[model samples]
Target: MKLSKKSMTVLSFTLGACLFVSTAFADTLLGSGYDRLKDSAKNTATLMEKDLKNYTVEALYSLKDNDQTLLQASTFAKMDTVNQLSEENTVTKTAKGETTSSYSYSDKKLSVRKSGMDNTYYVTEYPADVNRKGPAEFSNPFKENGAAEIEKIVDAVVGSLKDYVQVEEGTDGGKVYSGSLSEAQVPAVVNAVSSFGIKQMLHDERDLPKIESDIFVKKVVGTAVENKAGYLENVTGDITLSGKDKNGVQHDLSLNVIVKLSEVGNTKIAMPDLTSAKVEKVSYSGGFSSKYVGTYKNDIIMDKDGKFEKIGERTVVITSVEGDKVTGKYSETVYPGFESEYPNKDAFNFEYNPATSSTFTYTDAKGEQKNGTIHPNSAGKVYFEMNIEVIDKNSWKSSSLKPYYDGEFRRIFE
Candidate 1:
């Protein structure tokens, strides 16, 4: 019985980063023998990440069992860092003969995502958050960490190869290094080669396979070209995993990836032509998720002139919700001059509005209008809110006191 290639297992154990290790030198390798190769790749990673405001990267990776293609994917992205403009085209194929493709373009004002064969455009404004630097960005810096990690793995593997590494001059007056692994070695340095394969699987949290038998690395072959300017123009490699399935059937899974950097600081991303495609304008808004249904309480201690002359408590009890609206009751009481508690109680109904993140409009006890929002804090466990916005200019005390916005509310409901 032969183990099905589709059921191969994957083992992932990458290195731990040096915490707070001066961002610039975080992923630098301190080994010997491959200084030229290591320095060229490492410097490329660092320099590209420093002021990489424009670039185009093409990455292609695939996995196969025996002669059957289990998975294949490719991406080409062109980015403009300053304006956060980018255009990316992607393609993927699965084991079951299913294929999917997408093209996305982001400009200063609109973001269009097109998918499916017909290529319908999903248009929306730019998101509030965009990382332009990290390898995770996949744009300006375009996965620098992966490049860095691959470089380290290559160094470790090359260090183990020693005299086996073949070096030659490149066609561009650079250097070309080539090498291969015959059999998996138990040596720690050679074992680090697992990082190359593991990096592929862990990248973007790709789907992982499950195999019952322990898989081992069979062979690794790669070639990297460094330009005269000391930058890796291209890096290509393949890793083969051989093992048995649950039924003692042998299976061999191969992972292949190639990355090429081009058009550096020479690429331009422009607004896409949405004239022919189906363009849909969208407003991405966050509604009343299960996180906002509980009771919230905060204490206020300021006066009309923003002075600490009064003691107060603001409590909101949200009982129910329907659609993007919530029905609740609130108590705003203030003790001014340490005199008496002037409690203003009212049943409040707030319907969310489309704002930067989250917004709600409501009326106060004295028929005053107000608008506000709440921001989830600490992984959405607690909330910091400007629950008060654009309220009638009124004093808290009969004579003079105040209710400030920006309260720290805790907890949420189902």
Candidate 2:
């Protein structure tokens, strides 16, 4: 950001005046430190009573934050003092002064100057209008009452100045000065001088134009996936301006607007192939079981399109095996079953392994031991049959059993 020469001049003067006026009123004006000088200047500007067409003073002052000088907060003080000499003189003399000073605040540099003065000893700090080329032009000096009218003008200007020169919290969690005069304040000062009640003296001044502008923004983006069993696919994007302000000459400001979009729009995902998977055991039964009870486990592999190409082989070892109510562990390699019956198929297949054959010994009613073989005919078919017979037990009979399988699976797209 760049500032125009006129704006720079006004800002410099404003800062200089603030420092000078704040320092002049100190008890030991000649040998006072910066702090004492500021105090004296403010006191003198507060007390001095004089009547002149126009009066101005400028000063430069340093600001400190946590005992450290802040360079950015440093500014010039420029004040325009106006007084109604007499009603008899439509023409009023203008007195102005300029001062340059520097202050380091928080290790930053702030510089300002003060310019423009009038005959009146009372100071009138008007807001600078960047639009206008020169100082505000007034037609006449105002004079109605003796001291009261002059006092009001002085008070207004001083009050505004006092409010303007203080430090405030900055957006960056730092300290800043509120010394810049607003466009309205600039004209108000001029109006105050022209409206003085002393009918003998009258003055009219037009305010200069000042302008300020800024920009900001907020945005949000998110994505959701549905019916994806084990796969997780989510995407999100974001952009923000963060509310930044640009101050200075409007014309000198050049913004390079840049918008970069890496990715946008709908994404394509493939569904996992879930078909032809079989279930082995449902509950504790001697033959092929339909009721898949207890706990089971299986592995499934998916492709880029989220479709399953191959299901890993699993093996379930029965830790304990009983009689007609057989108990043991079952493990199997499961392929992608139909998407609709995934969970059921997945659960059933986990109970039995189609790739391996198992032989178990069971006790019959007569206390004789019987042997039986359990085998899976299909790799992942939904339903399969198994044959079981008591080979060594005389009283035990042979039984053929068919197991029904059911389970589910889900696909994730990224």
Candidate 3:
């Protein structure tokens, strides 16, 4: 009998009857069992038919060129059994960064292109010649496994649709529709429709330029069961883009997503200490000095009792002192070469001795070494002597030497 494709229930029962009869004689004593098996098969087929009619599937497809570059793409379609048999279907393609293209199908053939490119086109034929190799018995769509076969048709449509449209956006912001399908089918339907609308907008080229957006978690609140408080947790950030169409319009085109995050579940507070402060002092030291020299008319110049007259004295003073050291400036003037044939008649040397409380030494500039003790004066300041040496007579070349000029001193605390 020629069968109607819409009456899958009747066809499934007929097939089940044939199977039961073929197995009836082998289980003559179990005739009821065979009958039960037939009933079960019929029920399963009925449920499948119901499912096929009610199920709405949405899918996205991307079309690419032979070089694997994207050419055009479409948003997901909401397909069901009612519209499954038409040789032609309507699909929307939203190109990345451009306009959207709406297509019309017919005669088991699909064609789509930019709006004005009508005379020239790209096409795909259905019942694809390569897939038609089955036997005559399997050719009848109704006599075959209806629900499973229908699913294959849905898959093929989704696959073809991909070759034309591209997804420009994806989001988890909408409500989730979940539960026993029979109990929550209404909400599920609403969710499916809303999602399909989003997909449509994404696929439409005119909507491309309006697709950029940013999302962030605004605030967080926590509850505590005991006498304590809960702290805010790590927050995350996101950025998204809607794809474009051929006209450079962004549609359902979504690309470039970024998520920002921070460390989670850490809560501690820090405080400062205020009870351990104290006062302290620090000292530092430094200083500078000056000095001069004079020469005798003769080394043995007579005094009151034929004693040698002392004609010169040299001195130095610490100009400044700071911690353990003293700094001073000094200068010396002298007659050069008094007793020798060096050049000038004013040459001489000066020296000092702490044990004798006087500055005295030899007169030869190149032969004598002068030494002196540095002592503090009554004002709690320190001073030392500088020695002068005369090396020439005619031109009177003299050199000034300050004893312990750049020297360091230390204080011993008993």
Candidate 4:
């Protein structure tokens, strides 16, 4: 599965948040107590690397605007690496059963099928083809020694952060930790993450953007519960990022994650057979070009016009789709002046680089990409549901307008 930039950012945040707990380990954690925690983590890592382990995790992620839930979702995943197989299910509250996905993964390939909805099966090679193989492969942290390397980095980061953290025992026999690192403590974490000898597990060194002084973790809080056998039962945590976007809008991005593990050692995982499955080589072509238009009411009130617009219209143009490469353009124009009942207003063009435009990968309710016509109708239409980060070059500050367009383009010509 190819993660988009936003998804990658979330994954990076999860990895960075894991570093917070280590800060406490390097300092205020007691002698024997620290060893126990460290040993527990290490033992779990070793077992996962040597034996078989299964996990059932439920995660809820939300993005809010003015305390209102702009987006919220719950995900449940069951994975057993013994036979190298796993599956996941997800549901969103707003859409309820309307949008849900199921995924199955094996060592050699991955298959996705929409649950409670469609029949199209989206399949692809498991570990994407890359130059590196085995231990050297940097793609897919869930594969190879990737998991172990992350554990190593976590252990090392915790060990070296001793001087910068504070820890306390949880009331229920678990552990609680929190801290904000100083400028000098940042490198310790970096060095620790690099010490694992698994370079670029999270990101390539050269590709990593330069860190600013203000980019340090403002605050981190976490808790972990483990068994006497040095195995973790549950871990939960939240991290907050305080910063401003390119548009000068100050915002706080908060992420919460929960993990649970069980059935360690010699677990069985059954692999699925592709022989009987409806499998097709996914493909898109230029002949699929199309154009479409739709209309809606304008909700925004402009200052200069001091009027409520009656109508707003959107247009989409798909110039071409060559081979697996698809090209398209989108624009939404709103009549800011007096009532146009007929959408009689100036046209505001929102431009985007088609090459840079994110591909609109269609998945079933199960979230599996499949091969078929863009829309489920005879219209032969292409659709897009994307958050295109467009800048208003018409303005001096080049203000960012991350507009989201969800529409379909139907072929107007042959």
Candidate 5:
């Protein structure tokens, strides 16, 4: 397994599935004990999938070198999938006694962030009709795979290091699994962590520990527990590294992590009261191109006789932009059947990612996500277009594709 990608579920020290273990430990030695543990993991994953919504996750990370504590950091987070709300608070202290912290909260309409440096809270208000994302999903502390990530890694590590890892009964009728890694077996793990894990976890890459070519991993041990609901509730790991630098200077490094999940499906996001807090409220375009924040309409259609029967109008309204996402509405009202395909005044969002050819993901009136783009033509004229091949293949509302809607869109309002 590519440990860097998969084992990132938890701390570098807690992740051992990345290590290639040659010993085939006895699965029969513990008989049903092993099967029971495996069953617990499976059940826990199911529980997370079915009932995992609002929850709180706490992860504590500490790095030390011999008598010197290099870094201590903690991250506490709550997520409410139903309301599409989440909040995370992180605090980090360095060896020099310098501390930095930040808290960020996001709901359906607003994204608020507070920093410790100047006690400033930056608030970005989204546009009207913005809809929430998901209802019930659990992800990593960084919102990756969810706390269940630790469960999967633990199961894999235990399976590989059957000889080294042991399992016992947990207090709440859950299970406790522990394992150890020797120095020779931990270099790959530690190196991957230094090269990838630390960078991914720490908000500032400069805080990463300085390690030279010469390396040593003295010890690495971790424990994982399943809660009463069979969910992977907590994980703790400790790692020690001792080695000589190029100049033969002895250095000892230590890393520790404690990760816990609680209040599954009941955790609520307490939106910080900004009434008395230092806040900076600003109204800014929230998309790849703020200039797209306007209404664009195609020319009125003319019949063959050059006389307007029922004018065909295709209008695209980009109402608001915030952080690479734009909320707006699009409608095609072609004559003969002037009833329009999309509903009026309904808002949808598109992730404005210009790197991929300035493409965006916009959901149609039918609630299907489609690729769309809003850009300036060679004439510096902004135009909007969407690929409805999926909509066409599935069920197109129009009698046929209207070319005007896909053609030039002239800005009519801002």
Candidate 6:
């Protein structure tokens, strides 16, 4: 798959950071070159490709002011190597809660479903070329076939290891390592990983974003605790980015992340029934006759002294129609030139009595009766001049004299 330059940079940075943490713990405690935990790391990788792994990750993003949470998300993922399937259920909580579930097959097709408390379900499909493996740091970084470039970077930094310090020893009899790097070291660290070289290795040609001019790492420090198997059990780090905004204002951003793992080689895995879900189609307005019984839109218009005036855009969705009767809903926005008004989308049901304009009763502000009119044009178009006098609840009325739909609208569904 072709990766974007930004994507490659991000991947390289992520790999570098993960390698820094994992390699620090392994090398300081067990020694490098896969001499200490090679068997354990390889065993884990082998099991990952043979069994199922379940992981839960929680991410919280907050602004610097009052630590106000801007967004919070939690994801539960299941991977079954034997069946070559993976699934992720993520619930993102911001102003409201939205859940997105996805299933991926090894052969490269993915099924995704999104459902929220305040919205209807939405689904989409992704072909193989657009999909990629996730959690890119589960394997050994110092292995010859692994992130060898990252290893070289770590080795290059060994001479500059004056900042390495012992954070603590865990109750599990494991040593925790911590280190800090100066801003000057950022370029060397980035260069050590050979981002361009890695892209060439992967056969990608995306141009990298210019990072030296505007963006640079201010400081980076991390602490990690390892498990009995010599694998990092938990790592916490903070990376600060110092840059300038569009307005030329100085800005500094810091990101604190915590990563952990669980349920390796034995995770409960299940796939949902995609056939039972409903599919909703959305597309730009196209020419749709009776064969396209869906939504349509047009600019609202007005009749003034035998002259038609364009006001705003109108969107109508026809659910169904039977024997001169039409039922559906419409939404509209008034143009800036119109008087003070509030836009609204409402439903309406009307029977088309071609001989005598469909007489629909509408209710006004004072509960007075109003008459709404429905006029059908040629085979592919229609118009509704809603009665502004009907006082009926079932009738649809607009705030202006140009009631329901202000002008003619053609079918746009295919």
Give stretches of model 4 more than 4 Å off: 1-29, 32-43, 65-73, 92-100, 105-112, 121-218, 245-248, 265-414
Residues 1-414, model 3: lDDT tens digits: 111111223222222222222222231332243323323334433432433332221223332222232333333222123323211122434334444344322222222221222332323333343221111011222334344564343333233222221111113321111111111221222233223333333221221232223211111111111101111111111112123333454333222111111121121111112134221111111111221111111121212222333323222433443333343333323334322322222233323322223223433345555433343311223334224332212111112322112222222222
TM-score of 6: 0.43
lDDT of 2: 0.26
- Cα displacement (angstroms), candidate 3, residue 218, comes to 13
Each model's lDDT comes to 0.52, 0.26, 0.26, 0.42, 0.55, 0.44
lDDT of 2 by residue, 1-414 (tens): 112223333333333332222322223312323332234333333422232123322222222222332221122212122311111011111122222222111101111111122211111222232121122122122221233454353445455334323333334443222222222233333323322211111011001111223221121121211111211112112211112213343221111111111111221112212243221222222233433222333344333232334435433333333323334543344455534323322112112322122345544324444444443212221121223453222122224221111121111112
Name model 3 segments beyond 4 Å from true: 1-50, 53-97, 100-116, 119-130, 133-414
lDDT top scorer: 5
TM-score on alpha carbons, each prediction: 0.54, 0.13, 0.16, 0.45, 0.54, 0.43
Evaluated against the true structure, the overall lDDT of model 3 is 0.26
**Stretches > 4 Å off in candidate 1:** 1-33, 50-53, 126-165, 184-209, 286-414
Instruction: Indicate the residue-level lDDT of 315 in model 2.
Output: 35
Rank by TM-score (best first) = 5, 1, 4, 6, 3, 2
Please write out the lDDT profile of model 4 over residues 199-243, one tens digit for every residue: 222122111221222333333456567654556667665554344
Cα shift from native, residue 71, model 2 (Å): 32
What's the C-alpha lDDT at position 186 in model 3?
18
Q: Give the Å error, residue 370, model 3.
A: 99
Which window of ten consecutive residues has the lowest lDDT sum in model 4? 393-402
lDDT of 6: 0.44
